[model samples]
Target: MTDSVYVHMAEYLANPGIIGLAQSPGDLVITEFMANPAAVLDSDGEYVEFYNNTGSAIDINGFTLRDDGTNSHTISN
Candidate 1:
């Protein structure tokens, strides 16, 4: 994604309340991130788990994952 988009996302993720979407009650939470494993290489074993504390399902089609400000992977449906 472009730098502007990255900045926007970073801002949103950092404080959803800026747009009035606070994390109170329920929200998608990153519960775990496994970076190493005995059964596989770290690259292959790495995984992130998210939990939707809300009662309904969440649509994460355009969500993005970034390890740093300059790089990102967008989730595609």
Candidate 2:
């Protein structure tokens, strides 16, 4: 079987207003990615795109991404 990742919205952090988040499986999807680009540097080339399957727009603030190695990142805005 294949592995799958799930995305969930957070309802915390001085949220001034209601921001929709992934409520269940399949609520978010990796729509596109670019591991390598013809030009530009790796920082400007490698990328991943996510799509919201829900009706409302979801806020990705406070989200975190990491790998088995020392690579990690968090969305602050």
Candidate 3:
């Protein structure tokens, strides 16, 4: 599954000229995100994990996580 995702992203990046949309490389990615937990209730179980895929550090202070257009949460360090 990971291989397929990489393949698709590679294809998308390679054909950006045809799509007329250029995408720059990103540093952070959501390695794990769970809205519900098996061992605990939702109130205490929802969590997200991010990985810095770049060499430099990343500050995600102003980043936002949104489930929909109206509902969102800001990430702060």
Candidate 4:
């Protein structure tokens, strides 16, 4: 199994990085996500985990899981 994440930030998102949100609330939005391949029988496996890179809390159970773009799992919060 692998863990994937989706984050909701109340501001702008930038690539390569962003700056100038020191005194403003909801001025930056950043989400950290990752996914890895599933394990197979008799084979070495890799899994993915996600970390929150912002000052916020993420509700993981509210997300759904998919394999090959097909519905595989649905998390209930």
Winning model by lDDT: 2
What TM-score fits each model? Answer: 0.52, 0.62, 0.55, 0.33
lDDT of each: 0.57, 0.62, 0.53, 0.39
Q: Write the per-residue lDDT of candidate 3 for residues 1-77, one digit (tens) a residue.
A: 12111112333344554332224455457777765478895548877787777565555554567663355666667
Give the better candidate number (2 or 3) by TM-score. Answer: 2
Q: What is candidate 2's CA lDDT for residue 12?
A: 36
What candidate 1 gets wrong by more than 4 Å, as runs, is 1-26, 35-42
For model 2, residues 19-75, the per-residue Cα lDDT tens digits are 476656677777876544879766677776898898888778767655444565566
Give the TM-score (vs. native) of candidate 2: 0.62
Per-residue error for 5 in candidate 2, Å, reads 8.2
Tens digits of per-residue lDDT for model 4 on 1-77? 65434332223233223232222333323333234435455324533355454465544453344555443444455
Candidates 1 and 3: which is better by TM-score? 3
Positional deviation of residue 10's Cα in model 2 after best superposition, in angstroms: 6.7
lDDT of 1: 0.57
